[model samples]
Target: MPRPNVWRDSAETTRLWVFDALAGFPLILMLLHLRWWTFGVAVTCFVVFGVLERMGYSVRFALRRLRAIAGGSVKLGQPWWGKRQERL
Candidate 1:
């Protein structure tokens, strides 16, 4: 049997929770600002970012994904903490 992929699993979970919390931040702010459209956009971007992050993608990767959605083709996938440090 193969060893379990614990690192990836934990990374994904952390990414999801981070994005979820980020999404909530804007929503909470919106409650005071009363900007419904901005709130919606924030939520949408949060979900998109969360999905990309959970898929072993970095912030640049998430930005690239958004650019792709906006009709561009830019590839990016560097770990946030740099590749060498990731092994630690």
Candidate 2:
């Protein structure tokens, strides 16, 4: 049987994947409407956006962890470390 943690991880990964895909949809269409060289520039911008998004996700996850720790919820799932706590 799949663990609850596996499900959570899958959901988070899928959500991120969908978000990136949705955000890139318009850029992809615009690139298709432009010249091939312009598509290269679009690709570069897409890469930059992806990097920034990843960094932001990491920072937000860290902040959430810090807040949880401060609130005495250390026993909860550590989403940043991809660890799930066993129910006691």
**C-alpha root-mean-square deviation, each candidate:** 11.7, 14.7
Q: Give residue 64's error in model 1 in angstroms.
A: 4.4
Residue by residue across 9-83, what tens digits does model 1's lDDT show?
Answer: 664433344664444555676777777797887678777766766787766665566777997467578987786
Count the clashes in each prediction: 0, 0
Local accuracy by lDDT, each model: 0.65, 0.60
> Model 1, poorest ten-residue lDDT window?
13-22
The TM-score obtained by model 1 is: 0.38
Residues 1-88 of candidate 2: C-alpha lDDT, one tens digit per residue:
9556655566443333534543465477766688777677667756765675677754245447769878894564557567666798
